[model samples]
Target: MNYFVFGGSGFIGTHLINLLSKKYPNSVVYNLDIKENKQNGKAIYINCDVRKSIELDVPITSNDIVINLAAVHTTPGHPDHEYFETNILGAENVTAFAERHNVKKLLFTSSIAPYGASEEMKTEITLPMPNTPYGISKLVAEKIHMIWQIKKNTERQLTIVRPGVVFGKGENGNFTRLYWGIKKHRFFYPGRKDTIKASIYVKELVNFMLYRIEMDKTDVEIYNCTYEPAFTIEEISNAMMKATGMKRTIYKIPGGALKFAAGVIGALGGKSFGIHPDRVKKLMISTNISGKKLKDSGYKFQYSFDEALKDWYKDNDNLYLK
Candidate 1:
């Protein structure tokens, strides 16, 4: 069977493509994206922009697997319209393309943003109360794919993975920024240390997705993809310190003072400092998620939080971002 990955040039898609190539050596793998898959040259590239009707000239069959990873996910990074334009439209287009090809299996990478900001653990069954444009768009996109799944219920298989803060090599987001801050000793805890940031390593996140897809029993699968008992800020920071051997003390900065300092620095530095009041606010907010569903399914994660950080450290020459 052939494998098709939309937005496969991205961080998670790159890893998934690399893994697919190794695991299914004889099968054809197609990477369709607005940008080319420069890292995985083996994936047959297709210039695809899912915001509009997707037109593919590839030789795909009903037996092929289609994975949609295209979306504008970064919060405060894009205009509100950009999220809907890319996420909602991309979902519509991708599902429509899958329908046209009669593709049976499709996977979509969603986010825990649908749960909004929560200190309580959110599961797959949690009622989505998306607050941000990104979260709302993703929730809508999930329903869009779900509609596709139920339409061809007997034949179609859809798995939606809602991951929280996925980080590893090639990731340029939260964890990477944290890594740099820690390395340079600029990292400081803001007010509290108990802020839970639910997360899963990229390798483990993809591993869980593949595991769900490979199950013999065919069923509509949707689950929150995160480690159980999600790490607190202090826990995450200590793990990073242990991984990189950067054992300097992390000072706890007062919340109000830090916010004022960040605003001042950002005003002067003008985006170079990477310290914004909004960013500080985001850091303090907990994104607690539950993995009980996956765990209940007898799927074993390959990495613990500490081990995941350690593996990431090894992969990036001891500093995961570099």
Candidate 2:
């Protein structure tokens, strides 16, 4: 089988590529990344941006399975337009390419961001109330997949995996911020530390995606990908401390005060708070996601918070990124 993965050099995509390469030793895997995956020599790397379609050295065909994992994730300092171009336009290009080549299956890795930032528990049925362009883009991309699916009239398999905050080695998401800060013994414990984080580890998320692909027979499916049990921010902080074997002072600020301060600071700057706005919001509320749909698909999460943190810390000893 021929497998094509977009953004194969990214945190989650890289791990998935490694796993797929090993799982199907005899199969050919091509990674379409803006940057090459030097770590994985087996994948044929193509340098191109998914936002604008480009001709591939190797043409895609009906037998190929294309997985689109490229997007401007929710992060600090990124312009909203960037998210639109990459998340929506890039997705369109992937679906177009799949249809043009008559690809068999296309898996899109979306986010739980579309479900909005709220203390309320979320399920697959939650109406998407995306607060940021990052979330809106992901939601729009999912729609594009459906649009293309209907137009093509081909037996194209589509699976949309909406993952929560993803973290692991080489990750740059919310988890990275906490892990790095804790590693330096300069962690910030915003709010009362009781806030729950809707999070998922990268390895398990990748496993869920692949397992769904293996088991899927339908034309379209959507699943929320997250850990079985969620953890509180306080629990996570403690786990981080235990992982690093270091004791540090945690500073707690009132949630309401922090939110007010973030708004004032953002107004003063004529822009969104670089990092504090999102952080304060997360610290103030519980973000819970249900993964029952994915869990029922016959996959089990084997890693705990402490174990994931320890492995992540050991792998990235530098711990600090400027």
Candidate 3:
């Protein structure tokens, strides 16, 4: 088997590559990213950008599985246009390319951002009303994939997965922010600490993606890829503090102050959250996505949130604030 993954160098993509390579030992897997290839594999890296309808130089045939994972991931500094271009337009290009090449299957890595925030829990049944350009772009990407598959009568199967916040070893993105802040003993609890948020470890999510591609019978399905257990910010913080033996100087601040400060600091650095703004927002909002569909489809996750934080601390004991 041959597999092609776009945006392969990113954390989730890398995890996918590692998992696929192990599962299909005889298969060839290629990782495509805009950056120059600095990877090795049964698994090779192809430096390609998905922003345009450019033909992949890799020899794609009917048997190959194309996983579109590329995007301008959510960051405070990323311009809205950049998000739309890279997330929506880039998805367009990937779908177009998939159709052109007659790939056997196209799996898109979308996000829970498509569902937006809620005071209540979000499930696959919830209507997607994305709040940010990032979320809008992801929702658009899902629509594009659906439209292309429907209009073309393409034989290629499509699977869309909207994963909650994912974290694991070699973690980047939002998880890294939390990890670094806790490691430095500089993090604080904000708003109500009981705000429930869902997550999946990188390995668990990628494994499920592969499972759906290989075994699931549903056609053109979308699954909320997350863990069975949801956790509150305070619970997660306590877990990290226990695992790392770090002091939790987490002062609960008003949610209004956090929002106001995030705006101010976001403008200044365009990136750094002055007070870990991202974490503050996450702790106030209930963004816990359900994984019932995946479970119903006969899949189980190996890593719990506690296990994830413990492993992170174990691996980086030297980096702890102490």
Candidate 4:
């Protein structure tokens, strides 16, 4: 068996490649990305950009599995066109590769942002109302993959996982920002602590994807990947406090004040401090997504927020001061 991973140098991709290399020792792993992944010695690095069409030097056989994890996912980072260029076009290129090679399985990691910023619990069947470019691009990418699956019909397996804010060690996203603040005892709620932030641990997500692939299910399976009973800001803060044994006063700042500050920062051309107006707005919105489908499929999550936080702290203890 061979594994071809697009965006293999990324956080989730790095972890997934490591797991694949260990699990399938005999399998050849190809890491395709614009940048080289020197971290995983076992992976064969192929310098390729997904925004354009992919041309790999290695031969892709029918037995190979293609996993598309490439996308311009960071909100408030890139322009709208970049999202479509990378995500939508990247999906097209990946699916094209699968079609050309007659690959049996293709797994794609999409974002829950496609369900839009909603307070209500969202399932896979829910209609997508993507507001942001990142969200819109992801939804379109999923459709592209679905088109490929339909073309192949019963012969191919397609797994599309819409994961919510996935976090763990080495992750430098919203969770990392929160971790930095909490570790420094400078974190606080911008508004009500009850704002839901549905999330999943990276390790558990990778494990589930591998498990689903091994099942050899010949059909399209779309899952909203997140931990059960979506976590709130207070719950996450409490877990972080408990894990690090750092009990600091967490104050609630008014949302208006935070937004005003963000506006001021934006006006001043300030991208530092990790508080952009768009990010502030996103923080205020509840991403209450449901993982019931995955749960009902009999997959048990290995790490809870507390366990994952504790493990993360252990790995990054140097970043914290007593």
State in Å the error of residue 33, model 3. 1.4
**TM-scores of the models, in the order given:** 0.97, 0.87, 0.89, 0.95
- What digit string (tens of lDDT, one per residue) describes model 2 on residues 112-155? 88988888888888898988888899999999998776665446
C-alpha lDDT of all candidate models, in order: 0.86, 0.78, 0.76, 0.86
In model 2, which runs have C-alpha deviations exceeding 4 angstroms? 151-154, 256-277, 314-322
Q: On TM-score, who's better, 2 or 4?
A: 4
Candidate 1 residue 294 Cα shift, in angstroms, is 1.6
Against the true structure, whose TM-score is highest? 1
> Candidate 1: where is the Cα deviation over 4 Å?
none
The digit string of per-residue lDDT tens for model 3 on 1-322 reads 6988888888788778888888888988988888743443556876788986667666778778889989887656687899998988888888787778766688999999888878777778899988988899899989999876676454557889988878776666656677666765545556678877787777788888888888634358899887766777777777777766677577777887877776677668745443545646666788878888887887766767777667666656635421
Show model 4 residue runs off by greater than 4 Å: 266-270, 317-322
Task: For residues 1-322, write the lDDT of model 4, one tens digit per residue.
Answer: 8999999999899889999999999999999999987787899999888877777778778988999999888878887899999999999999998888899899999999889887988999999999889899999999999999999788899999999888877788898878667766545687888999989888889999998999867899999888887899888878877877876878889888888887897788865566676777787889999888988888877877778777677767735411
Cα error, residue 152 of model 4, in Å, equals 1.8
Of the candidates numbered 1 and 2, which has the greater TM-score value?
1
Off by over 4 Å in 3: 37-42, 151-154, 216-218, 247-249, 258-279, 314-322
